[model samples]
Target chain A: MKKFAIGFYVAVTIALMIWGYYQAIYVAPDEQTMHEAQRIFYYHVPSAMVAFLFFAISLIGSIGFLSFRRNRPDWAQASDAWALAGAEVGVVFCTVVLITGPLWGRRAWGIWWTWDARLTTTLVLWLIYVSYLLLRRFAAGPQVQTLAAVLGIFGALDVPIVYMSNRWWRTQHPAPVFGGGDDSGIKDPTMLAAFGWNVLAWLAWGLLILGLRYAVERQHQKYAAQEAQEALNEVA
Target chain B: MTSALWTHLVKDLRIEWRSREAINSMLFFALLVVVLFSLAFDPRGAFSQEIAGGVLCVATMFASVSALNQAWAREIRHQVLDAQRMAPTSGAELFLAKVLANFLFVSIVQLLLAPVFLVFYNLRVEGNAWLLAVVLPLGTWALVANGTFFAALSIRTRNRELLLPLILFPIFMPALLAMVLATTSILTGDNDPTLWIKLLAGYDIIFTTVSLLLFDVVLHAE
Candidate 1:
């Protein structure tokens, strides 16, 4: 299983790297409004989508852990590792979105950043994941895992409400040059196809990262158990 | 069932009454939160109805979290949960007793401050102040139900105080939104205050019901 994961990771990295390069160079038209800088959306949007997908999976794994409560500690740990890796990638994507988003906003809306819906929710989501990682570091053992699992489940539930309330509030209380308007002229077929391909590439990258992280977590758990056994033997 | 329920609540009250430590600390903590909030947004802004409403909601939440952490943390630290499990009380009775105790504490804070908030904010609350009496219990029910279960989960972990908010902020968003919107509308005197009230009531029902059903699984999860 580990070998298969490693092989798959190498193949996916090569494929995505090539596809990303191709999309950037050959396709994805130069932005008429913001010129070339708008191209970052190709990577940024895909990263956010993939990260959210992994977060959803983490919730599923948690529910499974709660219901089953077997010797499947590895599965629980794997899910945690997947979530961490996804957040790592998502944060990078969010960073690009945060940086280039403001740049794009400055060009289009005449402000570096606006306290608008998408921006605020994204920022909050970033904080939640940071806290999630911190919680894992602070808490360990079965009880800690259960607490983190409950947290993961609840945190995922918050995402939609956060998005909805922000949208509602933004519409009601408008921010300068931010709220009110969706001004994409047309959804060109080529751009749509490019986006589809990029999303696929991003999903592939997410799988590889999750797999690598899962392997590392499993090894760490095994090593910890071995040390405990050695300590018990020494005591005996 | 009634006797079991009575037993749980009576035992808890007896234990709490003996120490009075938990309740004292919780009350002080709630007061500290309110004062800090007032200071945090003062001079530049007096505690208007809007500010008062927001502060009251947040302070209640913080106080509930602080108190719930102590309630369940003490149980695990002392292995009282095992003793309770072996007692003649059912899980439901135990749950109900915890909920009642938490509700009583939170309500005391809310009641004591209700008039003070009105006076400080320079506003008259009309159209059934009794309505809030109904709303507070329902809201407290939801918060305490989930708060107890999460508190149980957090008891043995390190940095539990930090973990509680991280896990809670998301679960409590719906309640927070409902409470704020309902309270704001009530203060502003909307023609259809029923809408926000119904939303708050619905949130309370949904969360409390879900938490009650899940409390058994949580209590035994370890």
Candidate 2:
């Protein structure tokens, strides 16, 4: 079943990618201002959405780990695995967002970087999760789990504040062009179709990657437990 | 509960008063920071007033971290924390007491540093003095609340001095940003200081409440 699922995911991903490419290139209308360069938004926005989705998952996992770890070790392990997987996958997509954002900006705004509110907040968000991963790496033993969990909660809580501060700090970047209230939106159905297809494809890709990463985490945990048991047996 | 809180607060204050280690070092460190800032840039230059708020806030934050590190290190080194843990007092009481002690220490340092900053930076406040008065305590309380909590969190970690700041600075960014903007507005005579003050107070309330509730989980973690 697992192998079948993997095959199905790969097939769907390939099919969607083919359709997305066709739609982006042949079907979508040229953006009024940015022309061809604006197409990067199709990939950039979805990556950001996926990163946020994974961070939310990590937050849930952190909360679950903290609340249940004392009474239910199995649940504790599962939560820890989920958190580790979520962070790893979240960082991957955040990196994509960081990269694609600059590429799009350079084409549209004629600059590689600006301290725009959304950009600044995204940078900070990236830094917070990076630090979260570092804390997990440096703080060893059973204590690391609880410490990382606490940090995770704090990091997630800070997201809203970061967004608010940035929004109020300054407005250097352009406002959202989609769902940006009634004033903005894509009128071209073909452009919307292209964007929609790419978003669905990227979301599926993100989940597939998350599943593989989660499996790796669980296997690693099992191996570590086995090694500890063997060491104890040898000592006895 | 009040008695327990008072006892812990007094115990911490008594220790500091006897040794004068944390407060003295923090004060001297802050002075050195100001001096370094003055040396790094010409105080009479156009940049002085514009950057002074940032400089003051950064210096205070670094010194507060040192003070907070000392606060926890002494207790951990002497096993005082372990003893306190074994005591019947609740975690919230102990946490509040520590936060209060740290808050007082940080506030005093800020008070001393403000005048020195004004003298060295060759700057004047154009806004109401009352605004400065309001910004200082709210800002200090926000810093100390998180500082105390993160200090405790990093206590058991290796290389805690490094770890505490790494964990803290990013988390404290929003509060620090608000405080800096508020201070700058007061110095530059920006017409409205209301928004920045509200941000600082809101940050203080949110973190203090969250820390109070979650501190016990941190304390009892294995």
Candidate 3:
């Protein structure tokens, strides 16, 4: 059954990607101002949203891990697994966002990069999570999990402050195109359709990746537990 | 709790006075940073005034990191932290005491650096001196509180010197931003520090409360 599910997921992801490519290339109307360069938005924006979503998941997992360890120690491993999975997946999507963002900017703004609020905040968010992963990897001993969880919570809390500070400092990036105001958003239904389909496809991809990562984490935890039990038995 | 805090604070100060390790190094590091900044840019140039805020804060941050790194290292070195673990005082009180001691040490370093920063950067404070005064201590508290907390967290890690800054800097970015901005306004004679001051105060209060509450969890780990 698990193999079948894996097969189904792979097949569905391929199909969705193919459809999204077609819609972005052929179906979506050319944006009046940016023309062809604007097509990158269909990937860039959704990737960023997915990245933020994963970070939020990691935040929830971190909180769950800490609270569970404090109040119900039996369930702490599961929470730790979730936190690890969420952080790893979040980093992947954030990398996608960072890459696609510069490519999009080179085309849209005629510059490779800008210190805009959103851009700087996204970069800082990536750094925070990377440090989170590093802490987990290097901080050895029994307390590593708790330390990483604490760092995760701190990183999660900093995200909003980062965004707010950058916004107040300066903003060279374009105003939001959707829900920004009456002055923005797509007027063409085809453009909206393409955007909606691509967002759904990316969300589906993110969930599939997260599921696989979580399974791997759980397997690793199981192996570690078995090894420790065997060692205890040998000592006895 | 207050007595516990006072006792720990005095103990840390006495240790520092005897050895003169952390603060002296921190001060020299701050001075070197200022000197490096002066070498990199012309101090009397028009551009220096514009960047003076960033220069001063970055130097202070680097110095504070060194100080914080030493703050936990000494305790962990002699197994003093292990003894403290058995003390009757709550973890919050002990954590608060360390934070207060670190705050005092970092503030003194900053106080010494300020005059040097003015001379090295050729900066003149055009805005209210009172505003500068408020911004300095509030910003220092914001840095020291989080620095002390993360220092304790990172002490157990291998290569803690690298990990401390890695964990602290991202968390410190927002407060640093507010501090630099408020200082810039003061030095540039902008005269409106209300927003930045509020940000600094808010950050200090929130982190101090959160750190005090969560410090016990950090101590109980392992």
Candidate 4:
């Protein structure tokens, strides 16, 4: 049942992504300041949302690991795999946010980059998760896994601080107003619909990737256990 | 109850006094950081309160890191943590003792640096220097409290010296930010000290409480 649901979800997600891309190209707003290339927001935003979700999942897994021992490795591993999957997609999206943000900034704000809150925080978060993955490479065994889980939990704690820091710093150093309308930046109803669909599509893709990754991890664990058993038999 | 706490505390202090290399190295490194900052920046630029804010921020981070590493290094090197765990004291007592030791150790460095920082930076401490008195103790408590916890956990790892900062810094950023802002304001004579002070108090309370709660699971993980 879980597999069926995941498969259906994957199928619908791929369909939605195709639709999202088509809509983005044909129906979405033509960038007044950023040219047609600014349509990358649909993909970029969804990827970021998924990435954040992954971090959240990683935190939840860490909490579980900390709370329950010996009986929770399966759940822990599943969560770990999903978190890693989400991070993988997130990095891709962060790349998109990074590449497109500067372009948008140059076109709209007339600067390549301003070290604004969102950009800086997002970049820092990207570096952080990248390190989180690197740390996992050195961490092995149940003990190390739990330790990495603790690190993952603490690392995700930075997300809120990063966001708040950005908000505080941005307000402290206000940027000059370039665009005429309200700066909340959510202007159109159609744009909102497209954005919502884009988010949905990206979330579906994120789950799909995580499901695949979990299966692979389970197989790896199985092989590892088999190898250990064979080694024990040889010793006997 | 109070005697039990004090007993554990005295024991830790005695243990630390026996091997004082960690504290000595930490003090040296922290002062060196400030001197490096002074040399790296032009003297006029370095002495100003604005630059002092940045230096103070970096100083606390370095001091905290040094003390944390030392605190854990002693435990791991001596293989004393497990024995310490097997002692009559609870994990809570152990945690509190370590954090207090960390607090004392870092505060000693802070005390040493204060006079030098004051003279070098020409800091006046005009509005409520009492606030500085309150902030340093509380600020160092928060920094060292969290640092000691992370350090304890990191010591169990293969490469503690590297992993400790990666684990501690991000979690401690909020406290560090509040400390820097509060210290900066006090140094720079910013009038609105209310919010930043409250933030420092809040950070100290929240981190200390959380670390104490999690100390058992963290220590016994091995």
Candidate 5:
């Protein structure tokens, strides 16, 4: 039953993705001024949204792991699993955002990038999680979870500072405002519907992967525990 | 304030005083970085004022990592970390003392480098000169505090030296921006650096408190 349900969900997610792509590429009218380049928005913005949502999930999981470690070891393990999964998935989506944004910018803005508040913050966010992933890859011992949780907290704390620090530059030539009119421009009915579908589709896909990643991490943790138990038995 | 913390600080300070190994090494590495940037960027005239801030901060960052990589190495030798775990003292104090010791060493290097920097870059403090004093130390504290905590966090990892900067640099990005911009603003007299200074202070306080609070968890991890 479980396998059937997961398979069903995967099939539905694929269908949603195809439908979303159709809506984005064909149904959504070309945006004025930039035309085809604006289509990147459907994929780029939704991926960014899903990425932020997952990173927030990672932060909550880190906190949950730390608080629950003493009283609820099993719960702590589950939380750490979520933490790792969220960070991993978030980084994947964030990488998409970083790449697609530049492609769109090169066409739309006539330049590849600018050191604006949003762009810089997104870049820093990507760097922090990439390093978080590196830490997981390189670190060892029984305390990996504990150390990762601490770094997770620190990384999340810096996001706001990173955002504001760029703002502090207060340079005479202001950062080219990418999103200055972006929020309200979505009110056009056709674009809104297409955008809505793409957002839903990407989020569904991201969550499915996140869930799979979580389950895999949990299984790995259990396998390692069993291996350690076997080693202890041999020593005994 | 605590005597235990003072004892840890004093012990580190005394040991460092004897060898001056970290100091000498950081000083030379930082000097090389300065010379390299001078050759590469050709910090000439007005442009020098703009980039010197970034160069100094990068130099400080690279030099400090060498010290930070070994911040906990001494404790790890001969099972000294295990002994610390057995003691009743708070892990936060030990973390703080290490930060302080490293901060002092980095600051001393900065102080020594200032004269050389002035000659090399032809620096003239266009804004308040006293503010550099405030800005430099605040920035140094932010770097050292996070570096020490992270050094301890990475101590058990396989690639200890390599992992420290990989993890530390990203988290250190905002402070690096504040330090570089604040220093540049002061140098150029472009605008008030009070905002960046405030941002650095807040970053220092928030990260320091969190590091202290979390050090116990990291120390007792099993």
Candidate 6:
């Protein structure tokens, strides 16, 4: 029954993804200024949004693991899984934002990259999480969870500083083009619809992958625990 | 300082003073970086002032990694970590002491490197000379405090040395930017570095507090 439900969810997510692609590529009007290259913004902005969301989720999970590690070992293990899954999936989406941003910027700004507020913060965010993943890979034993949790909190703490420092640099940064929080540059209704659909679709897709990653981590943890138990039994 | 912190700090200083190994290597490594950067970037006139801040910060960063790699190795060996835990002291004391010890060593290296750096870059402090005192130590504390914590985190890994910088540099980026920019402004007298200086101080406070709160958790992890 669970398999059937997950399979159905995956199918629906794939359908939403195709619909989103159609909305972005065919339904949205061509941008007078940037033309087809502007379409990359549909993917780029949503990916950035989703990436930040998952990273936040990962931060919360890390906190959960740290708080629960002693009394609620099982809960801690599950939280660690969510933490890893969020970071892994978040990195995947952030990578998309980094690449697609450059491609779009090359057409829109006549340059491949610049050390502007948006670009610099996103790049540093990607770097911080990538190092988080690397620490997970390199650190050994049961302590890996503990250390990675500590690093997670550290990485999250750096993001605001990264954003603030770049803004203070006083360089000529072009203002962010999309979803700048309160004052969005996106004005057209058609463009807004396409962007909305893409955000929904990409978010759905990211969550699906995040769930799978979490499940895999849980399975691995269980197997490792069982192996340890069997080794103790052998000693007995 | 608390007795435990003071004790740890004094012990680290004595051990380091005996051999001076970390200081010697850090000074030589930093000197090499300055010369090589000069060779590569050709620090001439105003350009020297422009690049010197970045060069000095990067030099300190690279030189500190070797010392940080050894920061926890001694504790983990011969069951020293376990023994330390049995003592009636919080791990935060040990962590702060280590950070303090490492901070002093790196500053000594920076002081020694100042003459060599000035000569190689043909540099002058254009902004505020007194601020160099403020900027360099704040930057060093940021690097060593985080470096010591992350170093402990990576000690049991296979490539413990390689892992330290890989983890440190990325989170260290914003601080690096502030340090480099502040130093550049001081040297070039182009921009007001008050903002960057504030940013560095804030960064140090936040990261240091978090590190202290979490140190014992890391120290006792299975």
Q: What would the per-residue lDDT of candidate 5 be over residues B1-222, giving only the tens digit for each residue? A: 488799989999998999998899999999999999999999899999999999999999999999888768888999989998888999988888888899999999999999999999999989998999999999999999999988888887888888999999999999999999999999999989999999999999999999999999989987
Kindly report the docking quality category of candidate 3: medium
Query: What DockQ does each listed candidate score?
Result: 0.37, 0.69, 0.78, 0.30, 0.88, 0.82
Instruction: Kindly list the per-residue Cα lDDT of model 5 for residues A1-236, writing each as its tens digit.
Output: 99999999999999999999999999999878889998998998899999999999999999999999999999999999999999999999999999998898888767898887778889999999999999999988778998899899999999999988877653322233245564434657888888889999999999999999999999999999999999999999
In candidate 2, what are the lDDT values of residues A119-157, reduced to their tens digit?
988888888898888888777777778888888998898
What is the C-alpha local distance difference test score of candidate 1? 0.66
Off by over 4 Å in 3: none
lDDT of 1 by residue, B64-89 (tens): 78888877767776688888767754
Name the fnat for model 1. Answer: 0.42
On a 0 to 100 scale, what is the lDDT of residue A180 in model 1? Answer: 30
In candidate 3 chain B, what residue range of length 10 has the lowest lDDT sum? B41-50
Greater-DockQ candidate between 4 and 6: 6
Clashes of each: 0, 0, 0, 0, 0, 0
Alpha-carbon interface RMSD for all candidates, in angstroms: 2.8, 1.0, 1.0, 2.5, 0.8, 1.0
**Worst-scoring 10-residue span by lDDT in model 5 chain B:** B153-162
Per-model TM-score, in order, reads: 0.82, 0.95, 0.97, 0.86, 0.96, 0.97
Alpha carbon RMSD to native, model 2: 1.8
Question: What pairs collide in candidate 4?
Answer: none
Look at candidate 2 and tell me the lDDT of residue B88.
85
Between which residue pairs do clashes occur in model 5?
Answer: none
Q: Give the candidate number with the greatest DockQ.
A: 5
Model 6 spans with C-alpha error above 4 angstroms: A170-185
lDDT of each: 0.66, 0.86, 0.87, 0.71, 0.91, 0.91
- Model 4: lDDT of residue B43: 54
Q: Once superposed on the true structure, which residue ranges of model 5 sit more than 4 Å away at CA?
A: A170-185
